[model samples]
Target chain A: MSSSSAAPTAKPPMRDALVAAAFRLFLDRGYEQTTVDDIVALAGVGRRSFFRYFPSKEDVVFPDHERCLTDMTAFLAGGEDEEHDPVARVCDAARMVLRMYAENPTFSVQRYRLTRRVPGLRAYELSVVWRYERALAEYLRSRFAGQTDGTLRADVIAAAVVAAHNNALRSWLRSDGEGDAGTLVDHALGHVQRAFGRPADAPVRAVPVRALPDEGDERPEDVVVLVSRRDAPVWRVVQEWEAALGRA
Target chain B: MSSSSAAPTAKPPMRDALVAAAFRLFLDRGYEQTTVDDIVALAGVGRRSFFRYFPSKEDVVFPDHERCLTDMTAFLAGGEDEEHDPVARVCDAARMVLRMYAENPTFSVQRYRLTRRVPGLRAYELSVVWRYERALAEYLRSRFAGQTDGTLRADVIAAAVVAAHNNALRSWLRSDGEGDAGTLVDHALGHVQRAFGRPADAPVRAVPVRALPDEGDERPEDVVVLVSRRDAPVWRVVQEWEAALGRA
Candidate 1:
């Protein structure tokens, strides 16, 4: 209710101040003990200002998530390239959030610890994560609309992208955000991409196909065979067929 | 606060009474409007009994999820069968939850609608879903321990299973819990099994080898190559390979 604190109601400065003050209080006095009054007083802002920036004490803890989710949705939405692999595109969209976490390693790590300790905040974080996953799924579902098991493929790939992203993100957070999160996320996404990417076309190109000539005129066409390790990516098989049709 | 209400402190009856009363009040007067005292008074149970059964008003709205999650964890933990396909094992485990929802269609549907309206409850439900997914992931990771990309594969498969199950479950609930959820879930899980099952090992086995035929090699080993549509299930490919191998 202070007049001087209310003077600077212009967003970024006041919002950032409240967030800084809130996190400091959350770290020093713990999340439950820290009140809105405490955050506003520390930030030299009014209660109204705090409310303007964040609706609740819990909201202050996760200030960037809304923006991050919006950014991710936009990333997925803008992906209209015909040649872009849906799986890879989704994984790239997931990386947008990872980049958000990577931008503020210290704050992200601190928030991660706080959220883990507070059940309500943890639940809120899960909801946010779900939103990101849904955005990815919706995009993939549109791309795979009429294909066989398209819906299943969309849901699974989306879930896989989210899981892989979190696996990397959580691993980094568990290490107190010490390592290269970009690399971890890339490595994680790579696993998903190889497993479920482009059906079977891309990977099949990497495998060598043989045209073995047949002896008898009755069986005049050459026998085309592909021999790969038992664990080759599905794409390798898919690509070979595409190649076979092209040759025929 | 009434003495008559405080008379019956026996656990199970008291807990069930509280849940029943709370739901009735929640339906009649909305969740936020109904207080703990109102619930206890209606149930004819002590406030202590209400607290014992549920920690909060939000907890009452979601009475069975905790028990269901625990049951799912137990189901996954008991997977000692070497003969069961890991993917099928998980699909069966997911069925336990579907059965829980199917047992009380109206209640489940009501809860689903309520959760969609309430942000906090939706968040709580997401957390519960995450726990279910974690249980599935843990079971799969244990089964695929040393294989390449085992952890990623396990996590992805678990996520896919959970996603597919939810897709079916939600579609059923969206129809006001009409139709057979069991059949819907079976169809959904069938999609997942077809895409990622291990009937012929993983999807990596169909890569081609570079075998240009020697011009004079007469009637060289009959190159038995099985060609199927690119969209064929991994299991079908594996079965075909198995049958081919058998014939050979």
Candidate 2:
């Protein structure tokens, strides 16, 4: 506990040492079975050093996510490139997250399995993912500050970005991180960007009604009554309604 | 402890009695301070009856969600209405969940407050919400079984529906459930139905690129060369790309 001398230059830092030792023991013994004392003893460090690196054992399981979130926040804040579309920027930020996991295939896969097996760790992981979603939402909120129900827009787009990224990340992780994580995330984020991207002056051809904000809140409710033959096919009735509504 | 005498007709069932007892004790004595014995004693029930009703203390915090999930499943399975758009059907299902919360505003608000104060309860609530999300995803998956990337579509839409519903639900809850929860959820789910409602033959008007499946996975990456003057604004450059892509 008294040794303050730095380790040799070839050695990993005390933080990485703690994480490595913790995961090693966590994999050997179950997460609940391993203790802080065991991690520090195996890492050849003090309990104080372990506490210095991680707040708790669960923190050790997810060491890189905070740094990734910080990087995403900083990337989203670097808005000097005013030309960048907000949706595109958020998608790029989401890619940075995917890249972080793709960087360490072995560790990422191990952590994924560990998280799935532990209920506490699974809840902790959801909280972390929620923070990432919040970051994306905050950035989008800043960009869409002027729009109606912009908060709602920001929340939906952020959830879509996180959900899509997660969908792809889980797929790649399940495959033991062998395939292109980038491609999966890109495909997923494309859905978000296309759904929320550009519309005002240059609307795309198939979604004229998508860009309108929720102005229906102020309008009185309309109950449409469609009169059709009872034996008419449902699709035919729907077709008639769609034609009447200019949606066919 | 063996009381064969039934309660009067005016009395609630033993299950409701347990929930009321648990919440009363949790709010008065704090969740950590209250025990199963305290709850059973407050409800004038035997220890065995408390265990029979709820498996754990956390289970008492969310008494109705399991039944609600079952009911949602039943409502969804009653889908012989082939005319119903899956997106619309799921949106209706989301409305049922909102109605559940709206029906009992006072108890819902008290529960919301209790959940926010207890970390364990909050995590449990997240798990319950996750189950709801899975149910929506399963229904969407069944409806979209044959389409390409149907699973991806199902997952994204499910998350979006849940997120949007939560957004509006929380807003209403924050107001102490005084306002109309239905309108808020309707406005939110409109975003989902618009982005994904009917695409192939009946695309509305603007969003030509939004409906295509992730077919680009098999195709070589698209590299569009947009030749614009060096001084052109970024929007102008983007415009050229959009023009060439036929998305404008």
Candidate 3:
């Protein structure tokens, strides 16, 4: 599908054309080898037009990022309705970002490749990602304004959501072909929720308290034995704990 | 004291000398006007020596960043003893970063100014900051392994700590003159801890529960009140329920 076919487009096709040409040239002749003039020539646009569309050659690689950021901000600011839970609102906000990447997987993949090779572009992308985190944090802060841990909670939640989104997006991009990006994003978000969403003050009334061991015994009060190492079996640790508790 | 009068010095004087020279030159003749040759000449070092010390002119502006990062990594990695308490370890790890910035306020101030003006340097600095967050998050994940919310907790703690550090550092730098930076850093770290250190899944046995009364011939069980704000006063809400129960 041609970009020109879109109806009532405020931006000229030359901008998208330049971006498409830049990606093609970058992939064909390498990012460093491909010049601004080459990109403009390939797109059949003049030198002046290229500059008008983009401040620098690098701008061609990440077209509409600013627009996406604005859209995300608007979406978040509009999520002030009291009907939804804070967690739901956060997930919806994260979805806005996932949808953006999913909408243009081809361009995103090309951009990811170029970013990997170019330190400057990679840094730029990171900065953009940080901005998203900032926006999300701000929204969460506003939503949880009266809480003592509002800012801290907001910051952590924002970071976790962004990290999960990034991890999933990177996995998708790394694969040779795109699959169910939506499902991946959902799964990633679930991972984040499970990781950080444990109720900080959940009722502990039902917790089974084991009695303290006798004095002069090896087992110390206030000490909980936990198995360390990644490959350690979960069942083994649980069994060991249960046996130790029995002895106590 | 001269840089060379070293007694197991933390950082070489030459590095400090180069940074000072670069900052002065950047301020005197804009960032773009300054050159690597000028910095080396001002620092009383040869071009070859400068090259040996720093890879590029930009490196001089952020001389101790790599060391700071290394120190932070070491601090986090050294927390194997407290592996079960990810929150405390992450807080302490973040404090090490604040200490690094406070150790050299003058150089940090100059670096901050340069970063603000030079887009390239800003991007570079951001990448380093992101790396610090990444390291903190990874360490948190390792420490919090097997917890239901381990990854999310790690991500949130890392992000909050970084944000708190940045906020404090920026405030210190923006002031007309420096104050007790250590105290400020402590205050910031405390804020972060209070926010994210609340033990997720910690027993909420301390929470007081209250039942509400029936109203207008409708059973209290039929009427449900939803709290959408995270900051809603739980104690007040409980008190209201207690009063309603008394009425019943």
Candidate 2 lDDT tens digits, A1-248: 10112335322488888989999999999999999999999999999988877898899999877777877888888862658788788888889888878878999999999999999899899888878888988998888888998878888888888888998999999999988999999998887776677422321121112222457665432222233322223233333334433541
Model 2 lDDT at residue B140: 86
- Lowest lDDT sum, 10 consecutive residues, model 1 chain A, at A201-210
Fraction of native Cα-Cα interface contacts (under 8 Å, chains A and B) also present in model 1: 0.42
Residue pairs in collision within model 2: A204-B206, A204-B207, A205-B205, A206-B206, A206-B207, A207-B205, A207-B206, A207-B207, A208-B206
Any runs in candidate 2 off by more than 4 Å, and if so which?
A1-12, A80-82, A199-248, B1-12, B80-82, B199-248
Q: What is the TM-score of each candidate against the true structure?
A: 0.79, 0.75, 0.70
Per-residue lDDT over A1-248 for candidate 1, one digit per residue giving the tens place of the 0 to 100 score: 11222355433777888899999999999998889999999999889988877878878888877776766777777776678888888988888888878988999999999999988788778878888888998999899988876777788789988998898898899999998999999999987886678764322322223445566645433333444333345455545544664564
> Which residue pairs in candidate 1 collide?
A200-A235, A203-A236, A204-A235, A204-A236, A226-B208, A227-B208, A227-B209, A231-B204, A232-B204
**What Cα-based lDDT does every candidate model obtain?**
0.77, 0.75, 0.67
| lDDT per residue as tens, model 3, A1-248 | 11222445635777778888998999999988989989888999899999987898877777776666777788778777765456556766777777766778887787887799997688778988888888888988898899865765677677768877776677788773279777877887876554344323221111123336777767533322322222222223233333444454
lDDT of 1 by residue, B1-248 (tens): 11222346422677777878888888888877889999999988888988878888888887767777776777777785676688888888888889878978998998888888877788778877888888888888888988976777788889989999998998899999999999999999987786677664434233233345689976443333455443445556545544554455
Which 10 consecutive positions of candidate 1 chain B have the poorest summed lDDT?
Answer: B1-10
Candidates ranked, most accurate by lDDT first: 1, 2, 3
lDDT of 3 at B109: 80
Stretches > 4 Å off in candidate 3: A1-7, A10-12, A77-91, A137-157, A175-179, A186-248, B1-10, B81-84, B144-153, B176-180, B187-248
Which candidate wins on lDDT? Answer: 1
DockQ-sorted candidate list, best first: 1, 2, 3
